[model samples]
Target: MEPGQLRVFAQYDRDLTLEADAVVVGSGPAGAVVAKELTDAGKSVVLVEEGPPFVPAEYEFDGGLSMARTMREGGLRTTSGTVMPTMQAVALGGGSLVNSAICNRAPAFILDRWCSDFELERTTRADLDPHYEAVAKFLGIAVTPENVLGRRNLLFRDGCDALGYHCEPMYRNVRGCRGSGECFTGCRSRAKQSMDISYIPAALRGGARVLTSVRIERVLAERWRATGVAGRVVTPFTGRPSHQVRIHAKLVVLAAGCTATPVLLQKSGNLANRSGQVGENLQFHPGVAIMGIFPELVNPRFGATQGYQSRHFLREGFKLETLWAPPAITAVRLPGSGMALKNRLADIPYSAIWDGIAVCNRSIGRVRVRRRSMDPILSWKLHPADVSVLAQALWVLSQIFFAAGARTIVPGVHGIAPELHSLEEAEVLRDRPIRATDLVLAGNHVFCTTRMHGDARLGVVDEMGRCHDFENLYIADTGIFPQCPAVNPMWTGMALAHRSAQQIAQQI
Candidate 1:
């Protein structure tokens, strides 16, 4: 049965069943792109989201409250192994709604490695660049304009230039960005072209039906064929099941993210796991930051959330980027309790924060699918090798800060001095051994939970993102990456989704 047009929320209010040509779960970047692609090709699509659509005006601006509205478990989700906090978005646009809008293509070397090392065939820059180009055009991606590169970012650029390292403005999916620097709390300006403000609308225009506030339980599969899905309407705030939901479709696309997708399959039983590779090779670009305190005020709050970066150190296992967040979040990392901490918080206007994301392909982990929970238990450790890389990263950033004329740098690593006063002191971080448990790190880029391979024995999906065990089941998100892309994964994930959509369109 055809569902009513446009938006349908939990307000639909009863047992609702819909049938369409395709059903795409998760209304984030990949799902939104695929919904538009299939709908534009004249296939009716139903896009399901577990979270409600967000309005910019409703943004609470408080970190805890904002997480309550946007993230799973109010941002308390964490990894069990080396112990760094992580979060998954529970909103319609996924992480795009809270992310800084940085956009980067997968590096050519990483793609080449995927084919050479992970059995990915015909997957290279040559094959994927067109899709990347299309996504860039559709999102209005461009370099962050200098007019909004406030002191914090400009200082990063200055540091890079002084250190003779290559640095450039970040490419972001925003139009007329007013640089309110509130990207994490939700872009108040609505200038950030997150999917809800971009592709989801296009999908709607193309006659796709969007159903929000529904949590998918399992694929409606029998005899290894995806028939449809069965789920229930969930109240986004209360997390309570309200009504029954069933969707029948010709094709099923899973874009429910790395952790959630595998857990969904686990709940569905024997689907997508013939090779037993559904949630095995989890990887994330774990990153840590250093705060540089300068005598001059940097006024860190008035620019793009992340506007400058250096790729010069990518081969060294990390990428350096300038970062900004509300003082409430940053101040916690400052040392001392009492008046000493007071002085530190008061110095926020004079400080700038920079971070390095380790290219962590070797630090493989697994997502433990909880049988009765929406959230998965992640077990990942920072490899000893990655620990050294993290140390080297902090050391390098400290050098850049000193070169840029900062008075002091706060490394924020445990088991080390709280503050570094000179270049000589910073050397200890790199020259000596540091445990992975010491670094305060977080991950936004996650990959490889449902990696694609040409060999059926080795991977959960094929090169075209089709599950090895099912004909019409496709996975189109970062989860299909054979390795972490080692950069922002949004733009690259969407490009791959477009490729999958094209493949499906041709076959159907």
Candidate 2:
């Protein structure tokens, strides 16, 4: 087999047989890397995905439909009585297709915290630098330059600078972007080098097989050993049901994700590891967007989703990220309807809105078992410290935008848009009461559910990414992160997958 030369085993055209050296579920960065490494090591490998292949020409500009099709739970917004329900992708390339393509490696401070708090080895910046470089090179990560930063992005940079915040160019997994600014939706320009264009093709070239649009219901375990996986094919568009299929494998790697991974584990009735931590310790960088109504058109739809950011408040458990929103979505996010909506939409092309994401880093959330089904009980509770940071971060974002000559600032929180004329109005938020629900938080980055730790009693997976109790089962997704990295996690996810795949290849 060569890259892009694998056969599509249709659901109706069944040819079931599984005796691979390793079976990797979910053909995202994690599964693709694992499969490629295993096949490169001369092991037979099978990769399974839950979404259709990405065709650049067929890509759309609307992120909403993309989120519904490529994300789990249709990117549902849930509050498990603790944390807000966030979005995670289920596309052929997983989150790579939907993310901002920021390829940030693990900061030394974060890695140090991992080493000191979790007692994991080989996670230091020096130890992991080569692996990080290899992953970055593989993804073709590059910094977004001045030519690519459109008016919308430059406006954000100006605001950050005027506020005395450290802002820099972000590295993305893109080759030759034309600055269409539609990275959240599928990239029609074929600039964003997601796993669909990178590792998955390489894996297929190395004789790895891929099966898409198939849902894994449960892992078949025989006396604590994973022997096979069973699931049904999700019919296209019509929501029709289909028959179940079983894949037998000598080794099984679970890259389903933080929420789905533990559910699959619990469904197998293999709860041997009674640490009760397989699905706990979930983390998400709860973000809030500040929409500033500027006199000039911040036609935010003109460039990358996040090209610049404000890191002045990073030590305060939050960072300011400028995000993009299509005009239609931005209309709905406004405070009022009718005349007000028309007024905002009329100037949509000229409106320059500065979006800010308040990165929440101090909260610990979890996933619990629900009924007999494998649906995760998503729950999260924000610490008071995180709430305070969000307040301060939002205040700073508003002040900066105002200093940049903004008229009104619409906080993404679900209340009346705070029509601020001056920075003093923004300062009141610091003392005002803030609640988790009051802020507009999203689940775009869910991590640390099945964390990697040195102790068996504390973490679900070891530093090598193998499960604490199950020998053949492994976790190679965001679920395995011990803590949420301060920046975009896709690159870190890929690097960690590379490291884990190497370990799995050596053993299997």
Candidate 1, pairs of clashing residues: none
Model 1 Cα lDDT, one tens digit per residue, 332-427: 789889988898888899999999998998899998777578789899988998888888899899999999989888999888888888889888
lDDT of each: 0.89, 0.74
Q: Number of clashes in model 1?
A: 0
- What TM value does model 1 have? 0.98
Off by over 4 Å in 2: 1-11, 237-241, 352-362, 369-374, 414-417
Candidate 1 yields a Cα-based lDDT of: 0.89
lDDT of 2 by residue, 351-430 (tens): 45554444455677777767855567887887777777777777877877887778777776654344555677666666
lDDT: worst 10-residue window of model 2: 1-10
- What is candidate 2's TM-score against the reference? 0.93
